[model samples]
Target: MPKQAMENLTESMFYVLMALQRGDACGAEITAYAAQVSGGAVRLGPATLYTLLARFEKEGFLTDAGTVGCKRYYRLTAAGKAAYEGERARLQRCLDDAARAEITAPASLTKGDARDETARQGNRLPSGSLPVL
Candidate 1:
């Protein structure tokens, strides 16, 4: 079966959009900025960077700012900025959920302990409850 297309931004896509947040950048500059901003955690290869650039441009999320000799500069359009912000908000929610879960969970319970408890309870609605449509 064919893999379904991603509906949300991937980590690399998020970083690439972020790299263009400050201003227009060439492919190499975007990669460098992504690495620098991520504190060396995210690195974009040449192929992946260019491919994203092309896709973003085609999607109307980015615009060609200009070209300098062999390098072409790209900047985020309004849609791109919105997409970046949306991804940022989604990531923040994930972090917040993890933090809240950690704080509320008993210290003695290992990560697996919580899962085991839920499994023991069974994956079912309460006896008198009807599933929401």
Candidate 2:
């Protein structure tokens, strides 16, 4: 059976592709880079990272660059770079549209948004505290 082309990437997939932009990296290095770049917001566990690596390689977006010891490295192909850039642009457009809508939106729409949440209180939560609605 033929594999279908990916039309879009999920958040983790997008970050993994973005991580490769720094240079060729092995699985551990890519996971570290993604975490560092995302300020710990994205954590790629071993299983998830390996799955993505295998899938991207199959999709022609990545290639085996080298292997050192047990760790295999991956490099982005031209198609991978294009995929990253395309996803970035798509994300940017989504943000742009949201910004435009926010500006034109009626006041009620943004009342539950982050800005309001912040203003509701210099009311910051403590470490590990769940936010109060």
Q: Which candidate is the best by lDDT?
A: 2
User: Distance (Å) between predicted and true CA of 79, model 1?
Assistant: 0.5
- Give TM per candidate: 0.75, 0.76
Candidate 2 residue runs with Cα over 4 Å from true position: 1-5, 107-133
Tell me the deviation in Å of residue 85 in model 1: 0.2
Q: Which portions of model 1 miss their true places by more than 4 Å?
A: 1-6, 106-133
**Candidate 1 lowest-lDDT run of ten:** 107-116
The TM-score of predicted model 1 comes to 0.75
C-alpha lDDT values of all predictions: 0.86, 0.88
Q: What is the lDDT of residue 20 in candidate 2?
A: 90
Index of the highest-TM-score prediction: 2
